[model samples]
Target chain A: MTLLTVENLTLEFDTDEGRITAVNNISFEVNSGEVLGIVGESGSGKSVTAKSVMQLNPSNSVYSSETKILLEVDGESVDVLALRGGKELRTVRGGSVSMIFQEPMASFAPAITIGAQMVEQLLLHKKISKAEAIKISIEMLDKVGISDADKRFKQYAFELSGGMRQRAMIAMALSTNPKLLIADEPTTALDVTIQAQVLDLMKDLVVEFNMGIIFITHDLGVIAQTADRVAVMYLGELVEQGSVRQVLKNPTHPYTQGLINALPKLDDLDAPLTPVPGDIPSPLERPPGCVFHTRCALAEPRCSESIPQMTNHGEGHSAACFVTAEKAEAL
Target chain B: MNKKPIISCRDLSVHFPIGGGLFERKQFVRAVNNVNLSIPQGSFFGLVGESGSGKTTLGRAFLRAVPITHGEINYSDGEKDYDLVDLPKKQLKEFRKRAQLIFQDPYAALSPRMTIRDIIAEPLEVMNLTSSREETDELVREMAHKCRLNLEHLRRFPHAFSGGQRQRISIARSLVSNPRFVVADESVAALDVSIQADVLNLLKSLQSELGSTYLFISHDLSVVAHICDMVAVMYLGQLIEVAPTRELFSAPRHPYTQALLSSIPNLDPDHQSDAQKLKGEIPSPTNPPSGCKFHTRCHYVVEHCKVVEPLLEHPESSHDVACHRWEELMNIKEIPVANLA
Candidate 1:
């Protein structure tokens, strides 16, 4: 069953001066046992789009009327945006969908013990007693490979190392058995060795729990390791998306191609890094038509005159570029 | 690869004191264990390790930013020679002009109040190398031009610039003094991937143009593999491995280095090789393990490895390894973990 489906997710924020379109009109779906990666640099609006599914964006965010976030839990569908501050929203926020951040220290409360925080989260999400919640939390902790978890559970977040803190965060996030886990730069702060361990654990848990994951990051290497499908975002617009094999091996969009080229590969160290031509434009100075025309080498005059919709390249591979899209259709 | 080294260190170590009251026993965190290193002139020497591996502290010790616990660091640029440890006060101030540092976070390293021109010119003023304000401005302009900063934006504050541009401003500041050796501590780690390439290319080109040695300290292997000519792997405050970049990457000797290389997520999905996955966390630097600090996480452990710590020994051509069984384990493909049992 489909875990979540987002349609035409157009979001805007009201600043003091004016409004900025944080997320352009986009649509995607998450199915159980699949990982969808959203890749982009800063100002690319990847995080903003992920936050929209949970309605976790700030108060000033304005969603388009056509925007729809349909979340399904146990064969029952609910509109996530329509859910006001109540039990339904709570169920969706922590019960069905859970979020783990990059920095584990900031997420955990300073004064409370890790065990207490996990217990509170479990009790709030499920209809269980405190003792039952504690039991479940400890089991989750042990499952995340935290040795002597019971003793560590009583300690504060500061006592744990960086890698250990990240594991504890993952444990807390999974205690409720969430249907979808949104991991935003989860391993960006970890060392390579620790990241490998965590990545392996996450892959295993996805299979064991049989849940969907929306992994958001800027690293293509990580996306290749974890994601089944890839969505390449450039300045609030999703330029291309497809299966991991298609998008990475034969990327149709120029921005996605540039990103892959810029990444230094261990196997081939002689190739020089080719940075994308220009800086990501600030939202205030956003371009007129195709957002990436200023930096895109293949952009034409028509690219600056009108917007291009996604042109299909078969097998769910699509790109929103006049040049590449036309080429794909011609081929 | 055989050029005479510009900087050499022997018995280098940096240990910081932990909390200690009157009744409590004094303890220390041995950040950089006694290690020897030689950096060739005009080479991008990469120092790699995880957090608490003391790469940062080692870099600072070279610049004399941090007080060394015990060591002798000799610096020579074919013009002047200065001993970092026993230098006089006047010579130490003079040594500042010969060495400089670049910080990790470009956002914090640059001042928000100062304009781009002033930020770059501040180093010249502090060093008192220039005679007049016009000379400083000219030097700043020249360096900024090389760093690809727009001259018109020189009046703008750091907040007005993007992350890439802010990094450029800091680079211009560091290079304006014409230092012989520069330690860029995770300089491009905080930037976006697209911008990181630009900064790295700039660093590479500028290194060639200025003819200066660089200690590029980073935890990222891929980045170091591309730019560095030589690489050193640090573990638990010790230099476990050091070799030419190609030699180290192609055939790493140390077990820890092998695990580190294998841990990087290969971009090719089909290239996933579970060669050796490290087991536990790095032991605390304070109460380090008795024999070998990495023995706890090493896959191929033995009773001998648990009793005697191995010194850095060169068992092959130009490759240094700190493992006792490297030579014996070289010909064998796999030493079964069951051997430990």
Candidate 2:
């Protein structure tokens, strides 16, 4: 069953100059107990779309008429966009759908103790007393491999190491037992050794909790390791969505192909970086036709004149591009 | 190859006095201790370590950004030689001209108010490298072009650029000085993987074109592996081992180096579990262990390793390792962990 469904989602920002389309019309569904990786470069609207699902977009962001997000909770479906303000968002934000940021320090309060913040969150979401909440928090901390849990519980965020702090944040996020965990570039800040450890822990947590996850990052290698399904976003549009193996092994979209080509593989150190020839056009000056047409190497006159809809190629494999899969492969 | 070493450090250490009051016994936080490195002329040398390893301090010590507390630092370029620890103020200024640094965060390094052209030309103006305004502009344009920055974008401020473009500006500013040596501390760490490759390639090409020596410092071993000709592994400010990049990755001598190399997440999905993950965090640098710093977490650490400090000993071709039981450990069959298949 689909745990969350986003349809015709459109988000705009009110800049000083004019209304800028940040996330153009996009639609996708995440099933229960599946990891979906959103791959894109900067200004690709991947982050904006993820934030929109939680209604965490800034005050200046203007939602278009077609924007709709339905969350299936306890066999009932409700529009997530209909919920307004902190009071209503609390049930969905941290209680049902938790979010972990890229930088652990940014999300964590430096002044407050990790234990204090974790217990406070537990108390707010669950009807638990202070003592019980503290116990669970410590247990969760231990589960994440933070040594001397009780001692660390009293220590402030600044005292813990980078790896420790990230683990603590994960523990705090898991303490609520949220069904949908949104990890945004979570391991990007960590060292390689620590990154491997954290990735291992996250993979284990997903299996134990059987939770659906939205893993957003620019690292294709990392996404390939963890995500079961992958979605490629470009210039505020969902360019492609399919299983990790299918999409990664045989990407259909020209933009997706370019992104995969650009990535440096460890197996082939000699491969020169063939970057998509142009820059990501600023959101204010988005291309008139296809968003990726400006950068697509195989782009034709028709591609520059019209936007292509997502065309299905195989089971759950779809892409938005003028060229066919075989033609794109030939390139 | 006949040119003298660009930078050489012997038993170099950078320590900070912790605990206040004159009467109180001064405890030192040895950020970098007993690190010996000889960076040859025009060589791309990599310094690899995690946090609290003193790689940043060592980089700063080359530029005299941080004070050298102990040992000797000898810098020479065939034409001249100067002791970094004892250089006079006048000579230090000249030394600054010879050695420059590039910071990691492009966002924080460049001033938002200054135009890209002005940002790149600031070093030339401040150091009086160029006499006329036109000369400075020419040099800035040259460096910017070398860094792949569009000439049109040079007129705009840093905020107008992306992370990759801003980093190019930072690179241009660092290279505009025409320094013989450059210390790049995690220059590509903040960038995305693809962008990182682009920047790394730019840096590599710059080194070749300018024929300048680089002290490349980073936490990412894969990057260091691919780029640097020589690799030095540091643990708590001490040089644990130094070897050729391919040799270091293929056959690491020190246990710490071995663990670090194995931990790098490869593109292959199958080989991640086979890595021998290091246990425990780096000990507090303020009150470091008296003996080998890595003994606390080393799986094969013996009693002797905890009691006596091991010096960097040469056992192979230009390869140096600081460990008590390296030979014995090397003899034992390695546990077959998943290789990055």
Give the per-residue lDDT digits (tens) of candidate 2, residues A1-331: 7988999999999989999998888899888888999988878888888888888889999998888998887788878989977888986888889988999988899888998999999999999999999999999999999999999999998999988999999999999998889999899888767887898899999999988899998877788788889999888999999998878888788777777776655444456766566567888898977888887778789887888888888799999887765465565
Candidate 2 accuracy as TM-score: 0.93
Question: Which residue runs does candidate 2 get wrong by more than 4 Å?
Answer: A324-331, B1-3, B21-25, B270-272, B335-341
lDDT per residue, candidate 1, A1-331, as tens digits? 7889999999999999699999989999999999999999988999999988788999999999999999998788989999998676886788899999999999999999999999998988888999899888889989999999999889999999888899999999999999999999999989999999999999999999999999999989889989999999999999999999899999999999988988888888788899988888899888988999998999899989898898889989999999987776677
- Model 1: fraction of the reference interface contacts it also forms: 0.63
Residues B37-114 of candidate 1 have per-residue lDDT tens digits of: 999999999999999999999999998889989989999999889999888989999989988898899899998889
| Residue A12 error, candidate 2, Å | 1.3
lDDT of 1 at B152: 93
lDDT per model vs. reference: 0.90, 0.86
Q: For model 1 chain B, give the 10-residue run with minimal summed lDDT.
A: B332-341
Question: Which candidate's DockQ is highest?
Answer: 1
**Candidate 2 CAPRI level:** acceptable
Best by TM-score: 1
